[model samples]
Target: MRLMIVAALTLVCVAPAVAQDFTAAPNYGDVRLAPGFSPDPHLVVVQAGGSIDVDGTLSNCSGFITSAPDLRLFWDGNGSLDLKVSAISNADTTLVISGPNGAWYCDDDGGDGSNPSVTLSSVSGQYDIWVGTFDDGETRSAVLSISELSSF
Candidate 1:
């Protein structure tokens, strides 16, 4: 009888802990720009299972415009993703991508931001996108856009 009572007490103590399962949503956003010819870009944030449409120009990328624009996204680190952009004369523009785990990728002197899709290769979390000129005192511009996919 004492063993039965102890078993009941143990189950009652452990039930609440097991019932408290939790999952976290990731964060997203863009970084600020330093003083340069390129105007300060902007960003919009969406929910964990949300989508965002981006349209803007990386204009006048001359005179100390050595850094790329920042486009960031946040999620639960598990989903499908798509990043789309179109460009005009991308000869002077560059593409920079920042991913989870401190991964960085870039495209040098491309035709505007005219590109296909940038999909997440591994588990998804928060990723940053950016663009800029080569800082050679030559003006450049490009249009950017995005399309996101996920299952929450």
Candidate 2:
């Protein structure tokens, strides 16, 4: 009984260290978009980085982000074209997205310069996105762009 109690306490203490909850409300607002929506590249200004560390939390996910998502995107369209989600900033940035299929995708330096971009082959549902800095505890201004044609 003592061993079981200790084990349960251990699990509770360590759980938050590796958790990144995408179900929380976004820090920025949410956006709904369909394929070929006018204003091809939807953009939003965001502050990248947060208190939550993402290293080793999920496969290919890095950098630090808030407990809630920076942006939640509702994609109402077919998978004819790929969806491109990216961040543009002077500071080195990273991208973490939770797709509707419950898959987590991440990217670092996949865009121009030190920015990050993730192109989703499957594109049709809610995507909780987080823009983060490569370094810990560093928050910077960035532009989050969603497009099917190109990445920023």
Candidate 3:
């Protein structure tokens, strides 16, 4: 919560200088969201199951499911983003979040059930979010949500 507040303040302080263009903020990151991408966050749901290779960088994630899709989030340095995911039907779900910085944060059981969540504070950029399952053959339904907690 404190981080969100700080992020909010940061956004407020910077809002006056921000340009009206929707392009990625200068020096924020290498990723500029594709054209027509929505700046507002939305709740997304996708199907997950089967298997995908796991990288060693993520310590706790099982792996991205075969048919599961990735969600692209574009942040224009406005404020903070709280990324959350839930495996509504299956309790064995895990999450993998990869930012433009090439870092991945993995989590399991952080949500209401066995869901996962990651928070981005004071950073304006894009991220690739993946939902994975614990077991190779396990399949389930999951919901992905991102919140722009504050825009100044």
Candidate 4:
């Protein structure tokens, strides 16, 4: 009976941490691109920050992001070029990406100033991305940039 009680308690504790769903439709929009596509950097304006806290969810993952992804990227090309995803905001921003390989990558302050950037090497397929804020439930205007050469 004690073990059963413990199991139920554990399930309740773990439920909230699993709230972020990468499969859900994005808040911004989706983009399809191939290697060597024109416009080296594709930009999208977005609102960064949400209620979901990702600090203890995974190693190197921090900040607060929405349950739904902010953007979805469909890359139609061979895995030959590197892809860089970044966010530029006045407030401290973070980034989280679910790669095509089912791997999670996060970055805080990897770009200029308080922005965040994550670079994936030899990438293809779908990338679900979120631009988050360092603080919880604080939304800020941010520009998400997808680039092959440089980060903004």
Candidate 5:
């Protein structure tokens, strides 16, 4: 039970940022890290069987932005995941993704506050990503959009 508790605690980005409804993209579901999973920060294998989408709104996420305890994402397929912020609101956001053949991305209000996009290209593995407020603990609507480009 303790191991299950730990694993559950590890994968979720909780105490979110807003109060609106969230419609996650297709292939979306709760993802968990299984036992005996690789300690490799390079690959996050899925456990049980569910997939989190590339795009969705995170609501009421309460916390300050910090470099540690970021979320992990695994592409596991060839193509790029264009991770962007706020296709739905005017929340100022910062997105950082690292991994996959030296594809390290970080963006802060690159679009307009209107938006910003950080794309990870040539992906075929896991990645670690985080969404942060331009200011800490700013409870507002933050939308994350993930698009699969050149999917083959």
Candidate 6:
């Protein structure tokens, strides 16, 4: 009887450790722009009829420098959406949207380079977007905004 109790307690203690919560922020990595990329990589999961707000800065220079149009957002899925940023130099930033099947419903490539927004009518699961870098020989950075109306 004592052995059974100890085993149960051991399982209870270790179970939670194996189940990690990615939404806690620390689990997510920095949104970094690849070589010649702008905004970098940003990913999240949202439910149907949900929406996400995105606002950030980008540039060839290091650190958070907001000049105007620095990063761009692109969506490759049907139910997905994006808020893209552009500069006077017309820097190229590729934001690819991809996720699991069936869950990939809607999307939007947020353009205008200013402040952009997107609403998901019906979609779920994990989605990813890669921010490209401008060809100014400077590094680019971007801040991500996300919201989930449904269960993660």
TM-score between model 4 and native: 0.89
Evaluate residue 62 in candidate 4 and report its C-alpha lDDT on the 0 to 100 scale: 90
Count: clashes, candidate 2: 0
Candidate ranking (lDDT, best to worst): 4, 2, 3, 5, 1, 6
**Please, what are the lDDT tens digits per residue for candidate 3 over residues 11-93?**
88766331112232321122344223355345566665445645433455565454323555665654433433333435466
lDDT of 4 by residue, 70-119 (tens): 99999976666788899999999999999899899999988998899988
Better of 2 and 4 by TM-score: 2
| Candidate 5, poorest ten consecutive residues by summed lDDT | 45-54
How many clashing residue pairs, candidate 6?
28
lDDT of each: 0.37, 0.88, 0.53, 0.89, 0.40, 0.29
Clashing residue pairs found in predicted model 2:
none
Ten-residue segment with the worst summed lDDT in candidate 4?
Answer: 13-22
Model 4 bad stretches (over 4 Å): 1-16
> What lDDT score goes with residue 74 in model 1?
47
Instruction: Write one digit per residue (lDDT tens) for candidate 1, span 50-125.
Output: 1111112122211122233335544332433333322223434444455666665554433324332234454455
Alpha-carbon RMSD to native, per candidate: 17.9, 1.7, 15.9, 2.0, 14.3, 15.9
lDDT of 5 by residue, 1-152 (tens): 99998878876656343222122221223233322224422222111111222123333222234333134455554543342322224555555455656554556555554344565544555555554555445434544444442110
Question: Could you give me the TM-score of model 5 versus the true structure?
Answer: 0.44
lDDT of 3 at 40: 39
